[model samples]
Target: MSHRPRTAEAIWQAADLPARRLAGVALNPTAGTDVLLGLLACDSAAVRMTLCRDRDLPEEVVNAVLTHPDHRTRSFFAANPHIDPAQRARLVDDAHWLVRARLAQGPGFSHGRSELPEHTVVRILTTYDREHLDTLYRQVPRSARWTFPSHPEPKVRAFACDWWSELTPRERSALLADPDEEVREHALRNGRDLDPEYVERVLPDRACHARTHLLMHGALSRRVVEQVLAAPVGREDLAMIAGNPSLPLDVLALLARDPDPQVRETVAGRPELTAEQRRALATDTDSAVRTRISVHPALTEEERAAIDYRVSSDETFGRFDIPARMYDPARSRHYALSGHPLLRRRAAHDPGLPPDLVARLSCDADPGVRVLLAQNHPQAPAELLLDSFLAYTGRERWSLTTRPNFPTEDLAGYAGAADPMVRRLALLSPQTPPGTVAQLSADPDPDVRADAARHPRLSPRRLVELLDDEELAHEAAANPALPPPVLDRLVAALDG
Candidate 1:
């Protein structure tokens, strides 16, 4: 028999209903002030949290909820605009740091009308949530932006660096010279018209990442570059300069043969290389350098084919579809045996790789090549599959478990694995023992239990047991194993 739909009054009168259900009822326009006032006394934090943010909450109700012991409840209440200015001011000194921080960052605190004492300003600036600082920026005064760059807190100074437009040239220069690296980096990056003399001063002392940003931002000077190169810096320092696209062709040539293969490789890919320079690099001993030179636009078709024996560059990789097929048999065989794991890893997925070579990759020391072999090779060994599953716990395990006709021998082991997702896939597998499904139905994680609830082999009795679980009830009720009468009861319970 069909029961009548619950009316608002009936829902309110049903005091035993879950607090979350009552919270939803409180949102309805028909819930009278008496019903709302009664809900304010609810023991559920979730219900009180919802009511705390309600704009239409009566002053008396707001006052009552304000005294709620839960910090989260009071935090949401403090966020409500209806709180009087006097009360809002008092809330800044609330026992909870977050509650006070929220009020300090609120509009009234930053709008010049509510002046936070210097100590309170320092406290909020140091401890307030970083996520809310972007919103706080707009509410803060123009004059106050100057104080933060020099603030004792690094985070406060770093954040204040963003408001560069508000700072005078002297303040900007001071931040540029800030003793803290992050503060100086932020100032240099965001501050405009950075003095060339200042840029030169920081070049040698600045970190590599800072130098990269400086180059990218067009802040580097020719004099600074010459000074750094003239001094005995490491190859890494030179390599960084070589990578900059703005470097002159003469400097690129000088660095091209700079002893370090890495430095030469960085120079080889420079778009400014002349045809002669490209031809010179084609014969360089470093395969990495030759690989980059092979794709240079200046190289003739013949030059590209001569060095085409190896696949080492992104352009070379891009030329082929999956199961790469461009290399010669000897080259493919060479890569399969190459000591370098990078080549062996690439060859694992090469369709042209000889069957013997492909099989050899199964024992590759690098797990990545084995992972590729497992996913692409039809006859991949069981050890390779299992090893990849346990070693690389990324999404590949899920893919391996769900692949059609995956070996039944592996299913049992995975069915008992500690990872919930691995067990979840096992529960969905046809080969998973019925006993395992029954055990997983009671797994602590709701999602794992939900997966078990949807299994086709689940017993009707087990499905019935899950009908009252708030998280899994819907999935359990829909289980094909559920008996018709039990399903009807579940649907009715869920409806109410």
Candidate 2:
């Protein structure tokens, strides 16, 4: 067999080692644009990595890589220092944490650099992190150290306390007396080496959540607890101490008999309470505390079930966690017909709700409940969707139009609706017939015309006509209907 030099495309797809290595290393800007585009789609990670560093790579090319299915590739694109801040912001909510992490390194709002303003640095650090925290800590401005101790996340606050000596006396005192209980708890645990002077100042403050946090830390002295109880403090503060697991039996007994019902309620829910304590609380005059004791784990299973039951409803729904059992066929039906509007509203939104219940709620007297049925009931009757369309406006109307499996044929009239947004969405529907798209191609609203220009069914000549329109050209370029010859001419025009 006669040997001839293989073309770049042949080597780009070659099975041989030397040929593929040459393909990646030798690839450069001078290569044909189509060849570069083809190589950009190569299966090899090495080739992709090599292409990202090319000096002549255009911003348009980098933006195109953002849509690559491989997260690593998208992340590489995001980490490019030159990546536009606006482009980088698009990846912040990406599903993969690594992609967001890469975007964080860019110049925009990630506080990625050490040189950003201190307030901006402090604001960005409030969100939790794993990899970025330690690196960011060394770079954090000394002036910004005061704010982290009261940060919403306990871990971040704890991290800040690791360098406690750097904070001023006022900062230390403020952290100790912080209103958020978790921040105070972290301070007591992590600020052990700090001067006791701050603690002395925090101890005298009447309303600080720090007292209960100190109780949690086993650092509260008997004298301090006594002083707090005697201080003419509000019952809410007393209730917090009453709930403390490490509280002494003597103080617990005193609080158990406290005149305040909230204090009694707090003590009733204490996990460390003995069976004897629970039994004592069971007889309390407060019915709410009695109910708490019935369900308390300190009572035996039989004892818990033995309590006198009431048919009346609890004003505050317990937990409201909406467990899986709430979705059971029988339970959902019961809730759907209940007199309580909230229960009926919840049932109206339940996906597994019985079809008959869906029909009932569709015409619910409460418009909010009816809207819930309209949004969530997948099997909603056509008349209900139509009525929902006519009955609602603004977001509710827009929301109804976007429902999955929406009969697009029903949207045909909306193409000319008074609301331009409604008309745009109607025109964008996959089921919008060809004739409607053709008609909207000349829509007076530029936005509607832009959407029509990008429609996959748009004719090739119409796409060519949009080529010179800067607003629609990019979208028109993305239309797969454009012929290769047209793409050649478009590229030629751009180069000229």
Candidate 3:
């Protein structure tokens, strides 16, 4: 046999190794980009890790490989810190899990649950490992120690707040270093809101932190956030501070060019944002910036149309987080008409359904669309909600039963209805009352009995009086809230 190597197999094999391992040991500095790119282009996902490791690669070449149609190519870019915000934003909604997983690491990404993909969140919180969290936030000091008091998500900042007090000054500066106004505000808030000395701890350029803390606690002059915004020295830092509801218009303009779409979003999200701000963000080159404008309920159709213009390309849509817009009744209808399935899915999630649209969509061909409307309390018609419950039966018992908002009383009545799932939801409805739980205790389905048996609000004494059944007795005892006196009665019943 000839000694010539199989290039394709070699490329594919190279892609199977861990990205860090591939990036480590420098696979021979003398090797050509062709070998590197060939492995990057391989069928294996492992290539992404290696491509991210190459710091010496040219920017255009890196961008080209990043922008490659394959998701793995983009994954490499997300892992590469050198990729800028605009380019990094390109991977925000990449089709492959690994690509988005990689993107989650970049410094500016994943600020809120609103932007987080569901699977990624599941992976981050439930994966039983901090690898993904660490991968995305390796550069961020104590990624779990997110500080910066003004952050819109209170819990994350609070956790960070507790962590911040424990850190050195360099760590404190990282908390305020981001261009976010909330980050500044949080740092200003440092141990105490009223103390000026606490405010002195923030980095000088992002003095909006200290200023915002003072103004928030009513310790400083009016328009302190605005004053910071107008300062030429920290205009970028101040616009974020000015993002506070209390900041004036001129101050917000100073933050207008902030590289972060989220800052722009914060400005757009404010119902009171001015016409000039709307125009600027609506025309922003980034679709996310434009999506922020598009999702706003206050925008005129003409203004929204301008945003629609920027959204023509699929690339632009990836940068958009349309679900935020879908909650708006007016914009949701617009999204429902969009060509994208995901946007339509979001629109379908809106609680408000016009009577005619509601009627038409009750039989929507898409199961997810039908299911979403069933879940929406505001727009979903009562009849549709009921129909949706009845329509779901043996399909998946847990899905219908788990919804916290299903109409319990009405569902209880529907126990006599066709669908077992409907009957189950009806029985479990919070409003099912003691009367309904009693009735369903002896129902034919074990699952239904189990649900009632386990309900914390239901009295185990009621369970004994009602169930007169064996398995139900064990479940009723499990509830710690069940009065101990009830256990005595349960034991008496067993004795009988």
Candidate 4:
């Protein structure tokens, strides 16, 4: 057989190597517009995702993804967190509903970035059906919600009415009398939660989620409570009634003594619990009920300490750390000073804690409290960030390094640390020596090696050597330290 040199195009067109080649090229920050455009021609979905979804693309590549024949590729681009929201919003009117829905959901993991443009938000609200609207509603930025009630689009106005409880009296009145029937109806339905008669009429006879909502959140008349009690309610219904703020003292006392421990647990959470009720539930047979009472705001720290309450490590952190616009600093301060560690964990989620509270919680015995503080507070101590990063390996572990106060001054000292994650931190330090970068490039841990390969401190000669390295090629190409001439030549070969 005659031997011929393989062309770059042939290598990229090959079945087995294309995915690797495409990934390496896609990750190359120095890859020019032409090279990126060339990679888009590759039919591999993984390549497309790596190209369009993983990193911010050049304008030409973004345009190509916008018009790509594959809707799935377009969908991936739609949810990409790296791109501008306006760029993602371009897909709002996509021919495919799935693509539009993805656009409506905004970026998959926004780290407090800007929201979609107001006009784009209105366009999605007007076009999306109920199912897509529900998804879009959750992702809508809190800043946008305040303005939605005044939006010119009726659909947007109506969408705002869904949060009627949050609206000011004036905004509610305007929506109720708005010309648009749909907007008016949404306001009426949500506002009716305050109407004792309406709640009584709509309260379902059976135990359903809607009934639970009414029993727990709706304004309950004495008659409504009596009617609910008259029915043979389930454990859930009793629990919901126990939690209702409007529950009469007699009913509250009745539920406190209910046979189901869950009902007593809910009663323990009621803000209206009498001194006697509190004393009684603090020693309830159920540990969960006692635990619930242990953190009651009404109790003194000394009183809370006296209760034999147990805090589960599992309940310490998870969704509690997610940023919420409505998070109250006062409430967080209350929790931060509470005797219970679980409440302290919740308090640590507040980003605006006073310097005193921050200092106090940074030394909290609970690891979750410290980690939550590190994850949320902008001014979280550098030591706390490093400590949390080393200790916690749960969701958003990488987020700890992104904190504003995350220490980078002496991270190179961790290069020889036993933990691979600690070893990876060495690459983040500006003071890391080139020799350490080169040494870590051959680390046994794939993640540490990949991160080291992408460090700008890696020697030019070694960076070029890694271009042929299958495992490290993509990460090496992403390194900004690659020489211009070497990068141009690589792009030229890939462009072919």
Global lDDT scores for all candidate models: 0.62, 0.59, 0.51, 0.81
Which residue pairs collide in model 1, if any? none
- Per-residue lDDT, model 2, residue 377, is 67
lDDT of 2 by residue, 126-158 (tens): 552656444445335555566676666655565
- Ordering by lDDT: 4, 1, 2, 3
What's the true lDDT of residue 365 in model 1?
82
* Residue pairs in clash, model 2: none
Q: Estimate each model's TM-score.
A: 0.40, 0.41, 0.32, 0.80
lDDT of 3 by residue, 1-496 (tens): 4243234245445542223223321232433465455545544444444455334455555666766887545665665544444455455556666666565665344222223333333334333233545543332333244333334453344325444546677756655564656555666556454343443333244445544444434322333443454563543444345345545556567556677666676666566767777788788877666776676657655656556433331111111212333467776677666444335556666555466655655566655555565654345555555555555433432443334444445455765655455556765566667767766666788877766765655655675443334445434544443565554443333224
Off by over 4 Å in 1: 1-198, 204-209, 215-218, 294-305, 308-436, 439-496
Report model 4's TM-score to 2 decimal places. Answer: 0.80
Report the alpha-carbon TM-score of model 1 versus the true structure. Answer: 0.40
Pairwise lDDT winner, candidates 3 and 4: 4
For each candidate, how many residue pairs have backbone atoms clashing (under 3 Å)? Answer: 0, 0, 11, 0
Model 1 clash number: 0
Task: Indicate whether candidate 1 or candidate 4 has the larger lDDT.
Answer: 4
- Cα lDDT for residue 17, candidate 4: 41
Which parts of model 2 are misplaced by more than 4 Å? 1-73, 76-331, 339-342, 381-383, 394-399, 428-435, 442-447, 487-496
Tell how far residue 357 is off in model 4, in angstroms: 3.2
